[model samples]
Target: MPPRERDTARTRRTVLDAAARTVAKQGAGVSLDVIAREAGVSKSGLLHHFRSRDQLLLALAQDQVDTFAAEVRAAVDPADHAAGRLVRAYVKAIFDSLGDDTAISEHLLLSAALSTVPGVAEILQRDARQWEAAFTSDGLHPDRVLIITKAADGASLATLYEGGSNPAALERTRELLLSMTRGEGSFTG
Candidate 1:
């Protein structure tokens, strides 16, 4: 009988998904053996897909950033004409990820741990350039964009330790940020 063919794409997806779950629960320093075990593959198999631990972490980080960026881009409303449309989209994406009642919310928790990996920083910085250009050219004042985005970031941080966010508070903050983005609110009375 012939040997079974390896499903490269499915295998890579499984490995990345398992890595995300393990890394979220344990941290980036977790052993590749552990990831392989979680992934139901041998360490050799995992190494075959990723040359080294850092390489795997780098791929995971890039995937995380790219996924979040896509979420933000999708949230953008082309007809809204809001002052901070991009920032609004960003704020919406952050809240949406935190609000997810599904397994995918693990990505947010995983992201908090990904920063512990050395190669992850470069991934984030490189991705930040795209956001920088979008928000800088976005119709809102730079100060407004900065505050709205930072507030959303701080709120999203709650997911790091809590594994999720307070729904009511998160919704309220989401609305407030959206309003601020639309020039309908202010930080001061």
Candidate 2:
């Protein structure tokens, strides 16, 4: 890319990273001035990139969803059954995020706060619907797919909130969920 474009991208990334950390630490009500200070950019510079507070929040929310989707895609294996691949990818993504110390996961955990901003919730909701449709369209029964997905989500939430290692339980739950996807076990919920 051109130098000017590269610098612009770099600046944007720095600002976004700072914004995520500030919001995660300070909640969604944090001021743009604080974010600019954190990013080491002038408030005018921050505004030049994001235009407005709502715009910045929307960008942050979209970035979170995009990052999550990329993680899931990386974890997925094309040879696996579609349903199994989706569930495994999601579970793996959650675990991977939990293990990361870069604060991206913390930023994502602020989705509830982001949702309060005008367009952020819609972005998240759209991603959820897209994932739901993907799972439902897989050959597996929709109810089973949903149950497995919900279970994984619950496990992820528990791990995120509790903040500790319970490798045995997590492994067992992963195995059980994978087994269900493979048609090797029955689960009702």
Model 1, backbone clash pairs (residues 3+ apart or across chains), number: 0
Q: How close is every model to the real structure, measured as TM-score? A: 0.82, 0.85
Q: Rate the local accuracy (lDDT) of all candidates.
A: 0.82, 0.78
Q: Evaluated with TM-score, which candidate comes out highest?
A: 2
Backbone N/Cα/C clashes per model:
0, 0
- What residue runs in model 1 are displaced by over 4 Å at the alpha carbon? 1-6, 100-109, 159-164, 186-189
> Candidate 2 versus the native: TM-score?
0.85
Candidate 1, residues 87-184, lDDT tens digits: the string is 88899888877765444446656877898888788889988887888888888877788888889888866655566678988889999888898777
Error of 1 at 152 (Å): 0.9
